[model samples]
Every structure is written in C-alpha cells, then in structure tokens.
Target: MLKPIKRAVHFDFHTMPGVDDFGENFDASLFARQMKDAHVEYINFFGRCNIGWSYYPTKVGYPYPGLNGKNILGDVVRECHKLGIQVTGYLNAGVHHEALLRHPEWSKVNMKGETVDLDPQKPFNGNFFRMPCYNTGYADHLLAEIRELLDLDVDGIFCDCMLLRPCLCPNCTKEMLARGMDLSDEKQVTDFAEEQRRKMIRRIRETVPEDKYLFINSLPCPLTKDVATHAELECLPTADGYDRFVSQVALARPLYDTVVYMNGRFQCCWADFGGYKGKAAIENDFYDAIMNGASTCLGDHLHPNGMPEADIYRDLKEIYAKIEAYEPWTDGTRFQPEIAVLSTVPKLNQSHYGVGRILGELNYAFDILMPDGDFSKYPVLILPDEITVSGELREKLNIYLKQGGKILSTGTSGLMPDGSGFALPQWDFAYKGKDPMQIAYYKPTFEEKDLIHLPWECYEPGILLDASEEDTVFARHITTYFNPGYDGTHFNFYMPPKGETGHVAAVMNRGKNVIQVSFPLFKAYMKTFTKAHRILMKHLLAELIPQKQILTEDLPITARATLTKGEDYTLLHVKATYPEIRGTMGVIEEHNVLPAGRTVAVKGEFSSACLLPDGTPLVIADCAGYTKITLPEITGYAMICLK
Candidate 1:
C-alpha cells in the first residue's frame, strides 16, 4: 500500500508554554472537517514538540506546563481516526528543552565544552534547539517517552532530528576511551555517534509492533539503505530552491517502496506562525512531489490556541482536491528512467543533484542510483564529478561496458579508489593535470555558428585530456593567459585567451559507448547556471543517448516535465512556478503563466491524448515518427494523460 500514506499534513507544534495552548478552542468536529476538506489520508499530529512537552496525558515525560489536564493529542487522534484518517505520532527527540533543564549533563557538549543551544550573547543568532547527546543517559529518557506514547494507538512514530552530531560529553568521551579510540579524531567520534543513533532506532523498533512504522527524521544519512521502513526526504524547496524537490525525490524514490516529500508551507522553514505560501507555490510543490513518485506532506504550525489555522487549511483543501483527482493516474505507476546518475562517494562530492537537474531540464527521465545499484537496466550511466570507483565497482563497469552499457564520466569520476588514475581504460583518455587558468572556456569544434566565449564562472579547474585515436573530440578547452586584476596602470576589462586549443574538453569513445568530459561539468553547473554548461551537457547527452521518450518545445528552465507510465495510460506532469528572491526570502508570490504555443513530443503510440481531470482530447500530430501534442495555456500546473 506504499506505506499507507498518500496526501498528508505535518503539524509542527513545537511551541513554548506562553505561546502554546492545549485545545483551548479546538473543536473535534471542526478539526475533522478541515482534514476531510483537505482530502488527506494521513496526518502527522504532535504528541510532543521540541520544547519537550507532551500533548497527551503523559506520565513518562513532562506535559505542557499550561496544558491544564487536557488530553489534546488523544482527542485529536480519536477524532482523526473516526474520520478514517491515519495519524503518525511525533516525538521531538533531539532537542528536549525539559530534559536539558532537568539534566544539564545530557546536553551535547562540543569540543570547547559548550552546550549546543541558542547563544546568550546573540538573540536568534545560534540554533534554537538544544540538542541532547544520544550516547548519554538521555537515550533512556527518550525511549521511555516513546514507549509511553505507543500506548496511544498511533499508526506510526516519527522521531524528529534524530541525528547525533559530534559529541564530547563525559559519557561519550568515556565510551570512546574504553573502546581504545582517540577522542580527538573527528571521524571516530562521528561514527560512534551515528552508531548510537541507530541503536536507539533499533530499540524503538523492538518496542513497537511490526505493523506500526517507525521513521527517523533526516535519516537519509545513516539509514540510507535498509534501516528505514520507508523513505522521506525533507525538501524545503523554498529554502533550498525548487530544483531541490526533484533532486532529493529522485535520489530517494529508487531506494524505497514509498517516498514522501516533506515541505513546509512557510516561505522558508518550519515554525513561522503567520507565514503562508502562495496557492501556486503549494500546488507546484505538491505536483512536483507526486510527479516524481512521492507522497506529499505539507508542513504547518498550529496557533497558540490549538486551532487549525483557518487560512492555511482553506488553501490546502483546494490544492489537495486537485491532488485527489490526480491520484488515480499517479498511483501504481512506474517512472520510466532511461538514465542513472551514480552517487558513489556521497561523503566526498556527489553531483547527482546537478546531473539530475540538467537531465530534468532537458526533459529526460532519469534516476539517481547509488554505486552498488544495477546499472544494466539504464541505457546511459552518468559518473558525475569526483565519484571515485572502488576495485569491485571498476570491474563491474568494465563488464557492463562490454554488454553495451553507455557511460558518461565527468572529471575525476573514473579515478581509482585511491584517486590515483583512471580505472577504466576503454575511454583511452589520459588526464594531463588540472587546467592552470582561473576561468576556462569550452570551444565546440563542430557548431552551427560561432559561439560566445562562455566563461567557466567558478574557480574550479578542468583536467587537461589527451585522447587516443579510438576517441573523437567534440570540444576543446580554451585557457586564459592569466586572470585580469586591478592595477595602477589600468583595470583590464577582460582576460585574453591562450589561443592554444590542444587540450580536449569532451570526447566520445563511440566503439564502447563512453563519453568523458575532462572538466567537472555537473559540478560546474551546480555552482553556476550558465548557458555554456547546459550547452555542453546537452551536446554530450545527445551524442550518447540521442533517442528520447519525450521532448518539449519552448520549455522554460523553471518548469519541470516528468513522464510516468500507468497500467493503461501514460501520465505527463508539467509543473511551472516562478519563485523570485523577494527580500532575502525565496517565495512564489505570483503565479507565472505558460504560453499556449508550447508543445510536447511523445515518442510512443497512443490511441488518444487528452488533458487530465477534464478529459479534453488534444490534437496529436505525427512529426518525424513522434507524436506532437499542443498544450493549453497553463497558469501553474497541468497533467496530461495519454491512453
């Protein structure tokens, strides 16, 4: 059932006593009505919050000081369950204000012997949450709270901020010393802390029944593979940009049966009481999540009166009604991914996000696959910048190449595990060290017309390459003599190019279906958005995987297009929303309109093509063995279902 969560909302009731309440004006019927109006099947209500106070009548942990014997949590759970909506209990595990106040020693101790919390010297300067070290006796107290909350009959438990940062508390230091480990070593301390975090999750799992799901917030780092029951990515696109919604979802969806995109309704993050995102912004986020095969969970904060904010729920109801109508097309659908970006060394530098972004912008269906994943299913494999390959992985790639698997390796990606030299010899390209220029440029050898001198904006260098006769060079790196600087004589307007075009920028080993770029193409694009970056990537991708399932005309970079296959039809989700950086906050205050002249080309046979929700047939024309379908004027988001 894909973890039994489809449309949901996360109530981040992390409130303080003076500013928070306990169902003072909360009406059960009104609460159930709001949930039903929103069409949410699951909800993450608060049993506890970061301030270390319980909502339900609790005996293990401290209840809200001002609650006055109100079982608000139990009351909400009963109401939501009665309305046929599942509830996941929330526990603010990392920052327990009450625990820190009761046992000061349990607070996380930095190397400087300072507890990690809001700095007294600066107001709102440091992190507001006071993290408690899980390695200490605080773990036992947290577990006791979890067990106490389990008796409330929740469908699941979500432990928030469960990560264990580098701790130097007395308990942690003593354990490290006993293990014969150096306390000064950051890696050892961090790894030990991570193990302790996992141990706590295991303890929670053992305490809970098998049917109840236990999820740790931000658990992608330690429990990436098999530890978590489901996948949930905390993608606050407004804070991190809308591109992150696709990047994070693509990375997590392939690994888990169900993926949930947790985004806040605030302009940036959680705990903004009056901050409300525009209707277009919320709709775009929800559409993007479902298009990428993820369930949607909009995060919101309750008011001090324990009442569901009427304005937020009013907008949510309409947004989720649209989602409810589109769920039939999204559910049980398989996303056809033709490209895989390998995120081998996630700890070092992984360009999955950059690669995924570029691929999506170009209307390519792709997935971010780990190094150990089976790459044979994908026609093209992208080894993004700085992905060092182990001996075992190198062998696997070598064999996969012989089986006609295509590879697009970027700068230093095919390097040996120790970062010495190239592990795959089929490319027949030798790295001639990093380019000495501050900002290099790409010169396409074969182009329709003369191109602008696209400056490699960032200070990152490109590796000079020497290709053998077996490889064909499509582009060359243009190096500059030196960076122009302000001097006494005159400030140079521009730097002069070296005019030496011997270094190879991009090469294609057609015999083995391998394409290698000497520069860190994906990383460069991530750092700076330049036409040159997209131009070169597009050229290389076209040469490697020319045939595409879908193509679009006049598609904006702000708009993302995804194609998924249902049992009897194909679903196309076109989402576009312009989010301007308004006064240091990234928000979509206005909805951008999509012109009517835009068209989508599908490379498949369909009996009929029509716009979704209304079932209006579109004129599908045959163009070069592809079906071209014209799109209507879209205001924010549109879904096209082809049968």
Candidate 2:
C-alpha cells in the first residue's frame, strides 16, 4: 500500500546520552495536534540514532540512558496512529558509537592502518561516529535491531547512512580472500561493495513485512530494483546546489514509481538550530518536486526536550497548505514526454545530467531513459556524448530509426562498444580521427545564427567526421592553435582559431533527420554555461523535433514547464522562480509574476481552458499545430487545466 506521504516530515534526532532529559516535554496529544496543523500526513520518527541509542524499549539494543525507561517513540506512534497520520521508524544503518566502544576490530580500516572513527593525524576526540563492516558480526546485531523495530507495528522503516565502500577491516579482508576476489582491481572492490549492500538489504527485507514502506537513504540514488519499492532523494538545496534538485528528480523519476524529493527546512543538514529559508524558497522547492512527479518531504531535527518548534510548524502550515491545494492536479497525473534522452554509461557520465538540465530549462517535457527503457512512445531520441554503441543497443536503435524516429547524437556517440572506432551503418558520418587541439569555435549555417561565438573552448573535442554532400551542414568548426591541458583552460585565454573555416561542427542527414556534431557540445556546456552552446543545441533540436515542442512567449530560461494528463483533463505546470546566491547559498528570494498576455502552446485538443484551484474561464485559440492558451498573472507557480 502506498502511504499518503505527500506532505511529510523527517525528524532526525541523533541525540547523545549526555543529554539527560529526553522527551521531557513530549506531550503526545499536543505533538499530534501540531503535526495536524502543519498538514503533515506522514512522519518519520527515530527508532535508533547514530549514537547507538534506541528510543523505545528494545531487547536487541540498549536504550538511550537519558530516556529513564520512558518509550518516546511508542508515545509518538500511539498518538499519530489515532490522528490518522502514518509513522515510519528511522534507524541509523552503519554508524554506532556503542558498537565502536565494544568491538574495535569491527570498525572500518583505511589505507593508513587506522580506524575510520577519527582522523589519525588529529588528536582523539569523542565527537565523531564510527562505521562498522556489514560482513562481520555487526551485521547480525543490525538485523536483530531491524527485527525489533518491525515488531513495533510502525508503518515503515527508513534506514540512513547505508554506504558501501571498500573497507580494509580484518573481517572484510578475510571475506574478500575467501571469495577469491582481488582488492587491487577497482571493479572487484566495487562489486564487493555492491554485494555487501545487497546482503544488508536482503536481510532487512526478511525482517520487515511486504506491505510496509522500507526506504534506504543512499543519497540521490535509485531504488534497488527488487528490494525497495520507493526512492527518496536527499535534496537539500542549501547544502548542495539548487540545480541538483531538478537533475536528481529527472534521473530518478524514470527508475521508480514513488520518488520523494526529501528537502530540509534548515539552512544546512545536521544543524540543530539552523536558520530557516524564506517562505518563497520553501514553496519553490515544493513546486519543483511536484512538477517532476515526486512527493514532498521536509527534514527537521527534534529538540533535546522533545518539544515541537512552534514557529517551524506555523511556517510549514502556510507552505503545506498550498501543496494540499495543488494535490488534485499534481497527484495521479501521467507526465507527457515527447523526447527521450538515453544514458550511455553508468558512471562519469556528465552529458546525461547536462542534457536533462538544458532540456528542462528549455520548458520541454522529456524523460531520462536508460539503455533498456522503451523508446516507442517518444518521437525524438537524443544520444549524448561518449555513448558507445553495443551490438544489442545498435540493433534496438536500428529498429527505432526504422519507425521514422528522429535522432540527435554528439561526440563519439556512434562509436563501437569496444571504444576503438565508429560503428558504420549506424548513422551517416565517416570517422576521420579526433582533432589534436582542444579549443575550437563554431559557426552555425542553419537556424539560430546568433550562436556563432568566436574561439569557444571545446574541452573534450569530438573526433572529426566527414559530412556527405547530401547532408545539410549546420555548423562548421574552427581548430585551435594549441592543446589545452586537463584543466580545460590554456595560457592563451584569447586564442584564435586555426582559420576562419574548418570542418563541419554540425551535420544532419537529409532523409533520416539524424543530426551529429563534430565536438562535444554537451560537455562544453557543462564546463561553461555559455549561451552560445545552448543556442546551438536548441537550434538543432528545433530542426529535429519542431512539430511537438513547447512554445512560450517571453518566458526566461529559468522558468520550468511540464505538461501532464489526468483521466479527464490536462495540466500545464509553469513555474517561474529564479534562485540567486544569498548568504553563500543560492535561494529563491523573488516570486516573479508573469504578465497576463503570456501564452503557452499546448499539444492536445481541448474544449475549454481554465485556471486551476478556481475554475476561472480563460481564452483558448487553435494555432497552426498547437492550442494556444493565454496565462494568468502567475506569481510563483500556476497550473492551467484544459478539458
């Protein structure tokens, strides 16, 4: 069963035993009332903290010494159950202070022959938490604690800090040797780490019931396919960058059915009394989460006295009220994607994230697809830089292309899976070796001629290919004078091109509509957010997939747009909020309002158009190939419905 966790809170209370009075002011009735007032439907309370202290009476693990035999978790769960608010028990998976004190051999050993509890170079301090190996006796203790937690009758269990790294501990080393795995090879180490993670997840699944929610935090990661039902992305915009929220959602949305963007109220993570962001910032974050088909969760830390912060709840009341109002259109709607971007490699793949960000910023509905995902629904497929074509994937692409599909590839995307050279008969291009120099310039001969920026830096220059006479040459490249080192910069900041004209930077086959670029455009844009690079990509996409595109008048690139369809109506979410750097972090400070004359092009036919939340009538017109609807005066976020 899917829990009603749309508007939720994550209470991270990693309190130490030195704090004597635990949950002294925890009035169960008052806490439940506060949560209800804040419009929270689900809450994740602590079962065990990182300090190895359990909140409830436990037979497998020691209880918090400061609890004085009181069951704080029991009280919270009992009251929340009465109020119809689901509770999820939270536990620290890896770190334990008490376990470190008892068994030193179980701790993780680094290359320096020292335990990872503290930096060996510094003096010994009592402030750091220790991580234990999962292949040792600590795994048994963890399973016992998980069994005790499940017996508490909570709705779910959220395990935190479950990381898998190469540990040099005695037990881990022995297990690696017994399994005949060599530690020197990085693939072997990574395989072992994944094995350990799978083992831990399997053990936890054996203990918890199948009906309950079991979330494991692996930081902006996808759900372990068969083991986890939902995926939670820890999207703290202040701690990390604000761009990560959208990029992470774009990556995880295609992998899991239930993806929650877990944001925190604090300015930073793990800060007990941290500063709160402005109200506009919080609302912007929630809107972004919902726009990408994800649930919303706010992170907070409970005080040592167990008293709910009155001001925090008051602020959340207003923000969550808006979310509740938008739930009708936000939930149970299918995202209508017209373009699919394929992921080539698993790691070190920057172009995948870069393409998603650019496409999202352009207000085009798209999804990031893995190699195995279905591409039949999408009319346009984008193969980003460095995607080598395997035999299996090559066959799939050939079939997709035969269905009159449009394709856009860059760099060495059409190369063989072995990374030796290009795979012929895949696309119309002859492999001529890579350019010796690093920096290059582009001059567009097709649309968007304003993208001609002189002396642009091409970090990872693509292997130059020969264009046929039947193909259309979109842009031509300009070779550089010298090769820039690994830093992607050269001593000559203003180096000129080798000549005014060079090889073709962009080309498109006449009949197939398959476009290829001579340089790594996505990687260059990722390195430097140049307008020229984006314009080049946008121009190519417009030529490839122009019939089905989102057309907005006078909308900035920061404004995001997504179109989704319900059973009877279609929702167009247009979010216009810009995050600027404030106090060493980027925060949404302004809720820019759009004028009444702004128009958005909708794809489907509808009888009527109206503003959401209130069915105020709006004028709609039938354009050449799209339905044009005039937008209202939107402040921060707006959802227009057409039926």
Candidate 3:
C-alpha cells in the first residue's frame, strides 16, 4: 500500500548534440544502455527547462538548433518503455533556464532588488539557490514547459528545485506585498522561499491530474513525507550539503515529526553530485538514509554522450546488491508526523557556524531538518537551541497547538528566524561540573530512577516555578554553572548558538500529555539529578507513548523494537559513544558484531538470527512496550520475540 520509491537511475545530459548547442557528450543510446545495465526500477534525469530552447526536439521550443538527431528524450522514453522502466522529467523550481538570462527582469533577485542569474551561462549549479522558493516568474515559465513535457506520455513529471528557499526577485516582492508582508529588512528574506514552496506544490498538483505523478522535490510542509503521487527526487550536493539535506528528507524534513504526522510513501533520494568520485561515501550515505526511513537517488551533472565513468556504475551495482539483500520492509505504521532537528545547524555565535559539531552521531535516531517550518507531526518538538523558523511555519505551529499538541522548546529557542511572538525558553537554574559529564544510564536504571537531566544544551540556573500558568508544567530542575560569566546566550554544551543563563531545561504539558526535552534527555537533569537521565527519558517516552508500555530499563542503548500483528522484534544496536566505560570516551561502533555481553528476552523463542548473551537463557521480552532483556551494547543488532 505504501508506494515508496526504492531504486532510481539518474541521467544528466552532457551537452545538446544539435549544431546549435556547443556540448554533445551524451546521446539517447548511451542512456538507455546504462539504465538497462543498472537494472533500475525507476529513472530520474534533468532536461533543459529553458524559455524557448529544448533538450529534445519540440514544436514550441527548438532543440539545440540545426540538428537532425532523433529526439534524444523521445528515444530514451521509447527504449525505457520497451524495457519496462519509468521516465520522469526534471525541472528547476527556483531559478530560470539559460534563456531566461536574456531577460534580466525574469532573473532571480535578492532583497536589494538586483536580479542575478544562478548561473549566467547555465542554470544548474547543483547547490540550488541562495534565495527562497516563492516569488519567481520562472515557476510560471517552468509550468508552461512542463505542460508540454507531460504530453510525451511519460509515467511521471518530477518537479525538482521547487522547494528551494532564499531568492530575492521582483516578482517575489510583488507576491509578498500581496501577502500583506511588506518588509525592507534583509534577514526577513531567509524564509521567503517557503511560501513559494507551498505555491509550487499547489500549482504542480493542480497542473497535473489526480492520477498523474506530480513529484515535488520538497523538504517539509503541511506536505506528506511519504505520499507523493508524482515521485520526488533530491538533487543534493555531494560533499557538504549531501548528508544534511538527505537526512532532512529521509527523517521527514522542514517541519514535521516522523511518528505522529508523516504522510505515507514520500520517497527519499540521497544525491551524490560527484557521481563516481565518492562512491564509498555514496554507499555509506544511502545506507544511513535508508536506515532512517528513506529510499535512494544519486545526482550527476549532465553532459552529452558521457556516462558516469565505469567505477560509478560498478559502485552503483554494488550498493544495489546491498539494498536488495536487506529486504527492507515498512508496514504502514511508519508514516506519521514527527518533528526532528539537527541539534546542530545554527551558530548562535559568529565563530561556531562553520566549525560546529557534526550531527552524524545521532543520524540513525533522528532527522537533521531545515529551519523553515514548524514540525507539527511530532507530539513533542525538541529544540537543542534557538533555530531559524519561518512565519509560515509559525502559523502552522499555531494550528498544531490549537489542535492540542505540545512542544518542548528549549535552550535559546525562539531567538532565531520566523518573526513570531514566540519567545525563547529559559532555564531558571544552572548545573555545574568540572568536566563534561558522560551521558550514561541503562534501561534498568531508568526504570528505577525515573528521571534524567539531559545534556548538550544551554541552561540558566535559579529557583523554579510550580504555578501552572496558562500552560501546564511537567518537570524542571536547578543547575550550577561552572564557566560562569560567559554572557550573550551561551550554551554550556557543544552548540551553534550559546545560551547565557536561565535557559529552559526540560518540561512536559499536562493538558495534551505533550512533552518536550532538550538534547538527548540524559545530559542534564536525570544524569545528574537524584535519578539518571535514562530514567527521565523513559518517563518522557511513557508520557509520549502511553498506549505502548515500553520498558525503559534493561533495553540496549541503541535498542529499536518493531511490533506487528501478534509478533514483535527489538533491534538492539550499541551506540558508538555508549558505555561511559569509566575512562573509555566512546566505543568503536564496529565492535557490535564481535559479541559482547548480551542477554536476550522476547515474547517468543529466540530465532537463529541471534546468539545467547554469554549463554544466558533467551526468553521473550514481554515487559512494558513489550519486554526488556539484558543485551550487549550494540548499535545495529536486534532481539526478536512475539507478543
């Protein structure tokens, strides 16, 4: 029932083969051959969406002139159809095509009203735009071109780059005026793209019929992460932008949670613009992306007559095998709205933005989302710090709250973007320590202690308030600040934005039973409190998922449980940084397969997939959210049992 996109082959035109076009590295024959060789189920490729010129021979737009080649796209379509493969057309949503440069008026402009081409000579920079998504005449023109392209009888038309934000154009200004949002300030431009994004999705959906595939290469929205009638592709950058963007999409980006609100079948694509150069990197990326609930799509710059070298093809085949072997399954329940954050992006201080800590550590557990929207899908939206939010998302958040949702806004939240009246939360107290406290607490300890002082956040120290004001309260604690006197929003933990003092640590909502916390719940409160943070996280989890009585203690650090019908299995993977292990900073992740001390518990007999934890009796984990069994510190292994 989930029409998810699992595998896709991407093709880029090297150059137009016609006499009018200068480059001619690609042709129809080469593409068909490569796609067939790869054994791809789907195909995504970029075609020129220029004002008048066309990649294929079109009546309205001339093909690179003076050429008499069979329409390359036409041939590819024929070959692909013959081979039972699907073809989708790619377009630019933010910037104009090469021909649009001739009319500066149609170019993308920044806040200053100066129009500039993303590429004066070419349209595709692969990095998307520095501007926002909405407010461009190019979208209109792109629509015109798409209407023509759809006539080719392709299976679907993929509208790429439509969700790219941050463009300042004349039309954008006019559109903003129409929205009653007149602004001259420069910073307001950061989120101007999201509005247009909604427009772009709407236009594409309307233009395309109900049954036609209308793919919007979008991050998040009121949009569904899973359900796209038209397949979507993310043409992410290879190096810096790849993981961040892919994680955003796979984990359900923009503003929505993975759990409570995900729209089903939103196919995820991991872009590798470099093609063959960074194949291992590509493989690793796809693995992580899929693990986080997404499919894969690789990006390559188009050139005529050129294929992504032999190595690229070979690497693709290798990864293909890996993906196929996994036999991944998602049973409908995975599609729900859940909010996620990078715990990383913004640098509150000027120096930290580029040099901030990497988000790769928790990539498996959560999503690294963009700053344009408010995630309503999640029952609790946890902010590590203040982040860039758009006004559009603010409205969405208002809707979510009005419908009875809760948010755990922590650190220097509400300090970043989105001109909403929302204020950043403040912790009344600070907890002091000599060294950065190791975040450690087991499931057993959590079940016993039942509290956690989460770390990796900005905090302020003081007395607390028990009075339930307009909003109900859950939990709060005091902290002692060591490196005191650091002013101007200083966060004690590793952060892009530093909090000064009196930051919001953790709290829950009494009304909707919504709860939010800062960072990984074990850093501050429970870790240092009378109880451990693991205990606190269990409490939060219990509060969030009251329906499912998940046992907090006796579970692995990287434990994941999948329950279906009357059977269930808990996948337990040791964290790379688990086991405070006294002097050991963090464990090497690869050690999971080596078989450390592990105890197995389940509802049914242990299957052949597992080994006894040092010969402990394997039983069914029939505890709370099921059962909790003692297990080795593993990051990617599982405990299988039946309910």
Clashes of each: 0, 0, 117
lDDT by candidate, in order shown: 0.76, 0.77, 0.43
Clashes of 3: 117
Put down candidate 3 lDDT per residue, 341-455, tens digits, no spaces. 4343421221111111122221113334444444555554444434434455555555665665554443334333532323323222222211232221121212235334343
On a 0 to 1 TM-score scale, where does candidate 2 land against the true structure? 0.93
Question: Ten consecutive residues with minimal summed lDDT in candidate 1?
Answer: 448-457
What CA root-mean-square deviation does each model show from the true structure?
2.7, 3.0, 9.8
Ranking by lDDT: 2, 1, 3
Candidate 2 ranges beyond 4 A from true positions: 117-129, 345-349, 449-455, 485-494
Clashes of 2: 0
Q: In candidate 2, what residue range of length 10 has the lowest lDDT sum?
A: 121-130
lDDT by residue for model 2 over 72-104, one digit each (tens)? 787788898899998899988867777767878
Better of 2 and 3 by lDDT: 2
Query: What's the true lDDT of residue 474 in model 3?
Result: 38
